[model samples]
Target: MTTTAPMKRRAILAFMLDRPGVLNKIAMLIRRKMYNVETLTVCKTTQPGTSRMTITLREDSDDKMRQVIKQIEKSTEVISARELDMNESFWREVAIVKLEADEGRLETLKRTYPFETLDSQGNGCFIVQVTGTSQLIDDFLKDAGSDSIIDVARSGFTAMEK
Candidate 1:
């Protein structure tokens, strides 16, 4: 008999916490399990003294992922932890890129990509900002072309499932 390894899928975990180091502890727990994080985003919740952590992990088994979620929820600082379904989630990411372009090219770029010009230096460096889905940002970068890119800064991702 032959068996195949489980295919890896992306899982997002939202952690509701009331104290500090919870993020570190959660990450350490996952690290101890040898799972790699693809993207992690943390922010203060609207409720005071509580925060939310949005973590994306690449895992093969749903059961194992659930177990990890349980571990996170078991922590003293974590009030609750749950998986966010991608299908029912609203997600967003922001990216700022600096590229080499002139007045004409910048105009063309502004029209082509959903990016705003932050500043256009006299030295031919144009800084642009974009915010949207991860896929949309990636597609913009891919189509933006690499040769002109001088630098890039991206805010990982944040999501809420509806």
Candidate 2:
């Protein structure tokens, strides 16, 4: 019998107290549990003194993931932690890519990809913004070519249930 399960990507949404050291504590907890985090996005919510965090990682076992959530909820700073169902939830990521290309290539790229030009320098460097799913961003980067890309910054997956 097979002893290992295939690893699957998972996202956990956590609501926690908006105070100092809360992020550090939660990060330490996940780190100690040996889960590798792929992306983490945290921001203050509309509710005063509260914040929400969206963390994406890969895990092979559902039971172990639930156990990790239970452990996280035990923290005084965390209000709750639950896994988000990718099929039932809406998620998006934002990316800013800087590329070195001439005006003609830049125009061609703008027409080919769904990206907005944020700024352009006289030195043929252009900064653009694209917002979509992770896969969309990956495809955009790949299509843009590695030789033309100078830098990239991405805001990890932010998700909400339908």
Candidate 3:
């Protein structure tokens, strides 16, 4: 017999009223259900007084996901909530990496990864911005080698339906 692992990532898109404490209420509800949020991005929408949220989590069952969505939609501030189909959606993340490298290594790094230099110092240090799928960012860091990396900051997944 073989056991299949549960889905490791799921995304929910929600439209809600832009008001104070709305996020807190939704977050608290999810927390009470014991679901761990992987990434959450909230931003104002084009509609006045409205906001859109993209929340990512790991869930094992479709029923549970539906229950979470229903619960979220019950909130006074929430207009609607639903799970996003990964296949029909596009996802992206942004990361800023600070590293130390010589002039020779810098050119090589640039050739390997598509990134914009945000800042640089004469002392062989540089800060660069990389935007792409999460896997690409991970690969860049892994290939860059840990010893040369000073720090990294990542903007969690932001998604949109196709």
- Give candidate 1's whole-model lDDT: 0.80
RMSD of each: 3.3, 2.8, 2.2
TM-score of 3: 0.92
Considering TM-score, where higher is better, how would the candidates rank from best to worst? 3, 2, 1
Could you give candidate 1's per-residue lDDT for residues 1-162 as a string of tens digits?
A: 999875554656565656767778888998888888777888888888888888877776788988888888788888778877778888788999988877888777667678888887878888899999888888878777899888889987788878
Q: Model 1, which residues run further than 4 Å from truth?
A: 1-9
Model 2: pairs clashing at backbone N, Cα or C within 3 Å: none
After superposition, candidate 2 runs with Cα above 4 Å error: 1-6
Cα lDDT of model 2 by residue, 30-135, tens digit: 9999988889999999999999999999997899999999999999889999999999998899999998888888777667678898998869999999988998
Residues forming the 10-long window of minimal summed lDDT in candidate 1: 6-15
**Total clashing pairs in model 3:** 0
lDDT of 1 at 81: 80
CA lDDT of every candidate? 0.80, 0.91, 0.91
Question: What lDDT score is found at residue 23 in candidate 2?
Answer: 88
